[model samples]
Target: MPKLNLSQSPAVRAKWEENLKLDSQEKVTSSQQQLPNSAALTPQCIEKRWQVIAERTNKAALLDTDSEKQQNLYSSNIEHFIGTVKLPVGLAGPLLVNGAHAKGEYLVPLATTEAALVASYSRGAKLITEAGGVTALVINEGVTRTPVFEFANVTKAGEFVAWAVTEYEQFKQLAHSTTRYGKLKDININVEGNRVYLVFEYLTGDASGQNMVTFATNTIYQYIIQSCPVDIHSCYLDGNLSGDKKPNSHTMRSVRGKKVVADITIPAALIEKRLHTQVAKMVEFGQMTTTGSLLSGGIGVNAHYANALAALYIACGQDPACVAESSIGITRMEQNAQGDLYASVTLPNLMVGTVGGGTHLPSQKACLDILGLYGSGNARALAEVTAGLCLAGELSIVGAFCAGHFSRAHQRLARR
Candidate 1:
């Protein structure tokens, strides 16, 4: 098979070059006034930024009445501090989770404006609870940052890789020196022509660890530049190989933040009575969706993983952007010996944290408290609960589709 190359066409090339020229011109001519900038986490700085926004936009709605509390607590999490945006937090559970870390029923808080979302997840949660709950486990865990070093030629790259392998201990030491919670796990090296990418994987305790791994990688990079026997022409902190905040096949195969799997077996009688569909119909629908997923060239095969993850992450103060990679997973449905339905969801990159980021924020913290998953010892439990939540969402959505009520439910809830 031959790959289609659109850039090879003269017309396409000319259009692309023209677009680039216009973009460059726009960058030079744009007179967008920069907002007030500051590193200081004071109420004055926050007020200044908010004033500028209101003056320019002519909208003076206050974010909150208490500016001091916002400045004190939210400074570390955000910059250009202008109040906060609110989303409706909906409850979707009695989601019974039986897992290595997470146990018991949780009333999962989901923040979303999508009309039928909470209802769908709630319906699935109730069904799962009736079926004796879902089993969830955190199978693997790691956070990675890839640093690329460019040399003059392949030989120099090979020499750098050879020297780099021996410095794993020193690299570990330097990385560990930066953080008490993160530990250097392993370093994998990949060579491409004159460039070598050093993949540093770390075990970050209780946090998503994007910043943790970056700081650790920087420490290692600095040490390498000063101590390496081989010379490097150029280098970058991130080579875009770690699959951070992006959906890729690598994360689908291996783990990134936390790999969690959740499954449940529901009786056929319950499926028919509660879900308004038979086990056979659900399995058939699953097969059709799997084929459709393949045709679309999606990274993982699943139904609406993003819907659940996005809502949960937002409500819990996780980096919502992580959903790009975090939602990539495979969902399977099959029939057991008794013709009961067995459903499972495997999320290989569940980037989540129990502390840090937005977890400490008022509403987010309250949501975490609702699940009893706040503070340090609950990250893995949170991941397990998330997997179980996703399983509930998948079953609900698949059941809705199979029962031919998907559009009707959306119409009833979303439209009216």
Candidate 2:
């Protein structure tokens, strides 16, 4: 819950206008330092904010059109995402990013472009292995519950859903001590198979909804099986998958985690030969500036913030820390018909969440909310958008290495 002294909306609006007037004269400072981790705006509010930002920018080209924002986002077709399930929440932080993860170790270059998060993790992995390398094994997993709720049967599933559908104040009262539930979430249920599923969309507030979703769903599931009036028969919690680990709706269980895919292309020549060096060089560039080194700074503008926006997704949400999958970039060199070298780059994973974890930090949430890309639906979409932004950035860099004039568009917008 954010507190706003909107005792004076008009005054606040005036200051915003004044700030724009002042910013117009200066080089628009790089937003890396200014923007927060997230925001709380709904899609509609996000649009309005961008309209205001457009006015401030005084440029049609730079205006953040909603479609452009949406264009950067990706997701499975609506049908695949039409259903969902819940799983027990888990916590894995207190991540001592700036130093030793727990007290006595090495100093870290966190909060910098050159941070070495993966490198540090690798060192930690090395210490655990005797033969200089460690092997990872498959661990068991389960889905917490798979019950869908409509306007009715709220109580049967668990208290969280039961209360949210009621009046707002009643919900507020019930949520008073809610460790995590519906403040930053919503429920949309669609039935499939013999199961009634609950699409548990929660805004874990901050700290990634991991703990919040697990407990809330687990508590609710237990209540449903024990108290609900319907014939549950043998309810299964895997939502869409199954076996001995199946869980009944409204009870605690777990899922094998969401599937995240990333793709990249470097010309065959690049992949088969010399350009591997280029790719390695770029990877070196990423590592040199990632979140675990002192060189986190001086990595140039926007790069650190861009990586932060992406890395935060894996760290807080469900990526299982695929720093390597995301540790990708592409480079291309080709001959145009007229004979000039044409080159390009693409990065496809780069996950980012607009609403979960520290996204709600005063400024962060404001950033997410302003974009209207918060919460679950948006979380999935944001991962795609962040990837697109990075891909675009990568392309922009490659273009500069070849075609030239990367900032021309920005300058054109500034003139507008």
Candidate 3:
């Protein structure tokens, strides 16, 4: 292939120079535009920022500032405050959950822009509710922070690991000193040649403990650096072993946050009536999809766990980014001896909380309030509910696929 020189042509060269000049002018104009630098949560600062945005974009008509109130309440959650972006929140359920912590029928609030999503989840919820609700269980709960310590050789790494094992009590005490809700559960040492990765697991009660564990681990890291007899060549707060905020095979096998499982037995008649499909067909669809998922080298096998999880996370004020890991789960559908549809979803990384993060924000709090899971003593319940929600999503999507209504439903609901 030969490279063409557009500069040789007068028309092309003139057009290129004009385009460059326009790009330069636009960059200069953009550089000159400035918003308020103050991080104050005051309405005055917010208004000034909005004014700058309006002047610069001339397209701020859609961004409403009229809804701005209680700006200080958002101080902890946001910086360089501006008005909120409103998403259409829909209600799904009468999702009856029969879990250890989360029990009874609850209305699930789903904040999303996707059409038919709430309806699909609600359809599954209704089926589950009629079938005596879903049985959800908090199998385990733990958040992790993996701090890597590098040494000169494998001998030094092994020695550091040996010494670190004795200091578990001290590390636990140091971690506890930082947060009332977070508890250091266990520490597993992973050695890779000359590096030692300290995987610190914690039970974070009622709040998603990313920042909590990070702070506690940093404290322990500093203490180790100062007091450890072993010489460390290098150190990092996170060694990516914990799989925070990313979908990986590690989180699929082990828990990164709360591990929750939800299952429901839908009668053959109920499956036919509600889902417009037979139990055998649903099972067959599940088998094919599971095989396809495995063939694709995916972390977890599921139809669309992210759909329900993203909506729930947004509505509940949980970190939306955690949905990456939280959505990785296994959805199984099999016909029981009684010919009923036995469906289960095991979510190993359902990173959620009923306190902290965006949970206290007005709309988020309101959503959590709707589920009656707005504060402490409700994190486990929240996780259970999340699993149930995902189960509902799985059933609905699978039913749609089996019934040959997936694209038709989307066309009717979304393509309009």
Candidate 4:
């Protein structure tokens, strides 16, 4: 590939070229001394410069309404707003969900470039809807932020944990006092050597509560510092115990956002007719996959949960990075007494929100609105819908694999 210099005006280009003449090491040292446009890198100024670069590349006209919308939305959330890269958005659904909060048919907006993904999920949705929709429930809801403290000895740490346990109500009050919408649910203590990790879990209303839990946990930390009997050797806000953005057994066993499960019962005849596979074959494949996952020491055993979660995250304006842990879960199918296949997906750490984060952006809001998941009182509804989508995706992939047409579908849709 050739280098494309889409720098600003002639004067700026001249400066950039002059700097480029130096050796790599010297250029790095010199650039550190003086940044490019040090005083004029405001959000608005940055966007203006990006416009110039776009023009130089003969793509200035591509910077249309989307550029303006994204730039404006990013101003409040980011320090520097350069530009927006467009991801092709596709629609999949009329995914029917008989969920506690989410009910009725929903059109799932998916943002992806993968050719066959939307089709596969839509096929699953069709089967689910035909079978009278997926049943979904939000079993639990909490977002955790852990803080670790190191004491001089294990004894001191134990003592501190005991103290924390005794005064749990006081700490809960302190944590709750920090935020209007965040409520402290519980605090779990883990002691490793002389260090103690306090896993503070909170119910963050209608929002992914990373910031909310952080703010509340800090208040509890302050209370401990002032009132605790033990002397702390070292302390930090996060100790990786919260399982944030990382897949681990800790998060899979506990709750992150809403521990939601979605399931459906498919008659054996329908399974064979629609999926092109018998109920016994589907159950066998599920067991095989589960065993394979277990042999690989996987945290969650499932087929392509991340596929559905990532598409939904991008379309709904969520923290895309959370898909790391959020996608970890189990997909199960069994042959019932009535010769039907009972399929279910349980996502333990499905961290999502109907408000805050990127949900307010124009395109993201539009996608959320497609599922009627915009604004408050719909976080659980969103979780249920997400779980249902995951189940649908699982069925499509597993069915395709079992039917020996996985590659055929991909070659037909993706190769084009």
Candidate 1 residue pairs in backbone clash: none
TM-score, cand. 2: 0.28
Candidates, ranked, lDDT: 1, 3, 4, 2
- Residue 299 local lDDT, model 2: 17
TM-score of each: 0.91, 0.28, 0.91, 0.88
- What TM-score does candidate 4 get on C-alpha atoms? 0.88
- Each model's Cα RMSD: 7.2, 21.3, 4.4, 7.5
Best candidate according to lDDT: 1
lDDT of 4 by residue, 304-336 (tens): 989988988998999999999998998889999
What TM-score would you give candidate 3 relative to the actual structure?
0.91
How does each model score on lDDT? Answer: 0.91, 0.35, 0.89, 0.86
The RMSD (Cα, Å) of candidate 1 is 7.2
- Model 4 clash number: 0
Model 2 error, position 400 (Å): 8.6
Predicted candidate 3, C-alpha RMSD: 4.4
Which digits, one per residue and each the tens of the lDDT, describe model 1 over residues 246-326? 999897778999999999999999999889999999999999989999999988899998999999999999999999999
* Candidate 2 or 1, higher TM-score: 1
Which ranges of candidate 2 are over 4 A from the true structure? 1-177, 180-184, 238-393, 396-416
